[model samples]
Target: MSKANRTLKKIKHQGGRIVPHLILITYMVIALFPILLILINSFKNRASIFNSPFSLPNAETFSLVGFETVFGRADFERYFLNSSIVTLASLLFTLLIGAAAAYALTEYKFKGSTFLSIYMAIGIMIPIRLGTVGILQLMVRFGLVNQLLSLILVYVAMNLPMTIFILSNFFQQVPVELKSAARLDGASEYQIFGLVIPLVRPALGAIGIFTMIPIWNDLWFPLILAPGTKTATITLGVQQFLGQFVSDWNAVLASLTMAMVPILILYLFFSKQMVRSITAGAIK
Candidate 1:
């Protein structure tokens, strides 16, 4: 109403905005600083790494020796391929199986459905690593102890509980009428699932992004279950490389930078969908 009041309100609103922006910038710096430091040092020589670690790579300090050393010592291509296979396979089975389990539990009234849901959900609370001894023994018995398939199976099992929990909530929000209408028109359960699965692509994508990270970054299972050079994921490969080349600063930093870049690119591409779907799923 008055100029003074309007000015005061504008100042208050601007002040409110400043606090959040400052907090966000602080968090961004906290998160990205290590990655930036790694990238910068990855380009510099060992002497520069210690003396000018904060400075950007310059003509005098810049080098690719680390990358060269990395390529020389490790079969990164094989490691990448192994990681890609395990991650993608685990993602595919986890989503499909989790979706089906979620659908059955939420849409059906069969006996023990509640108990089964609780049983599956128990995995979410318990870390899968706790059962590593039993898992390793079982895999050995099945002759899958040192194979990529073991990693895929273990990752899928580890991720499935959270996947089912997220999807079951989203499935509950899908109108019952949609399924009824499809059934009335002669669609079978399989067809209904086929149609419904696509409809929840956003939510699935969100969960996929969430599920894929830990699997990709996991070093424990890969180290224990599939530590062979041919079976090592990128994370395990990097760790092993670092162990042998601990004195090689450039290679160590380069290896870390390489490992971080792919995931960063992936998150940037899918982040919008992931955030939107997560919010929508939560609201539903």
Candidate 2:
């Protein structure tokens, strides 16, 4: 009887675990099904796309016409280059400046430091898009309306508040003794920062991924600020292409796939770092 009871309990425990796994698997499928459909249809002919949209590509249905159309119809390569430049430049500026500001707020004592921190933190509650009109007017005043530089600056400003907040939290967790010891060893503040940065690198990796995605996927600023210029980013270009190729199903799917693949690859690469940092934090 005890043996049977033990077996029943083990079964119940396993069943409980399996239920959550099943739920997670279901969510994963739901999330991925649309992307899978797009990728599957991207390689299919227009007839196949409409006729068997849910089916996988076969020998008779496989086509590269969509990709060819996208290339021929859009300056897709330039759009990608513009996006890459803006995302990378903005990411660099946000991390470097935000990290320094965070470290300063966490480390130094100054008049109005607390108020200044609060002032910066307020940007988190406010969406930068809310100031689009003012930003556009400011850009026009400086003749930066259609420039990639303007896009980069806007992204940097948009991402800075959150970056500083996250990095400041991490900086606070750094051992004051380490900084004190370094200072005792005649290390200047810059030297201490250099030492601390590598220790917080995993957190930095997490922030980089967080900051890059929004900037990469953003359509509003790019559309409003850099429309019609060669500085148009991939998201804006894809939107324009979709509008132009409304009936061209294959071209639309191909352009989407092109735009998605890079960001997907980047996310997958950094996701590990993000997960690791979170896990490490929990452990600590």
Candidate 3:
């Protein structure tokens, strides 16, 4: 609390902002450096990629042969559809069920509510793959193995816990007065939820992004539950292709870049919503 010490502290605080950018610059390079390398080399022929690793590709040396080969070898269209179908479907169910559960946990006071919340939340930390022994057995018994439905069901169950926890946290932050007032005006429980969840649509946006990303990127459930050659997801397909064509640098890089593009596009488009959602629920 001395004046000289206070001034020194102020200088330290002032320096902190500038200091972070150094770290940021370093981390950014660390993060995007590989991506930058991949993108630059992707356009080059193999010899140029190896010879001039850091140089950007130029028109003279650039080629699209890798992409052509990847497209030529696989049913790329089917793989894309399989991934989209599974990711979209799983995301839809996770959001719907998770939101409803989160709302109930926050809005209602009932017996066993805490226990039920805990029970559902166990999935957040425990990988559902542990239960695959049973799940696969059941799937086999039900004849669901190698089916898209199996992937969807496993993903939904795996993702539900965290989604519910996030939505519930946000639901609790919603002004209780809003719900009471809605009820005062004759809103039913269903109507209250419908009206109120939208108010926190920002949180839902965050939840949707969070839920969708993992399912889209997941290789395990798709590999285990539905690993037929014909039904491979984009992630699984790309990985398989890389293994099969390890020496085909062009095809390998193209597949990686292709997989990276969709996620990058989604994040760019939704970054505002994602950033807002993260900040909105943060406790000061």
Q: Write the per-residue lDDT of candidate 3 for residues 1-284, one digit (tens) a residue.
A: 99999999999998998899989999999999998788777778888888888998788779888889988997778888999999899989988888998889878979999999999989999988889789989999999988899989888888889988888877877897988898899999999989987876777777878878888888988888888978899889888889999998888877888888888988999999888777776851
Quote model 1's TM-score: 0.91
- lDDT (Cα, tens digit) per residue for candidate 2, span 1-284: 69999999999999999999999999999999999999999999999999989999999999999999998989988998999999999999999999999999999989999998999899898999999999999999999988999999998898889988888989988999999999999999999999999987877888887788888899999999999748889999999889989988899899989888888887787787778767876786
Candidate of highest TM-score: 2
Tens digits of per-residue lDDT for model 1, 1-284: 99999999999999999999999999999998988999999989999999989999989999999999888888898999999999999999999899999988888889999899999999999999999999999999999978999999999999989999988887887888999999999999989888788877777888888888889999999999999998999999988988998988889998888888898999899888878876776676
**Order of models, best TM-score first:** 2, 1, 3
Model 2 local distance difference test score: 0.91
lDDT of each: 0.91, 0.91, 0.86
lDDT at residue 133 of model 2 (Cα atoms):
95
- Stretches off by above 4 angstroms in model 3 are 1-20
TM-score of every candidate = 0.91, 0.91, 0.87
Q: Model 3 scores what on Cα lDDT?
A: 0.86
Listed per candidate, the RMSD to the true structure in angstroms reads 2.4, 2.2, 3.9
Clashing pairs in 1: none
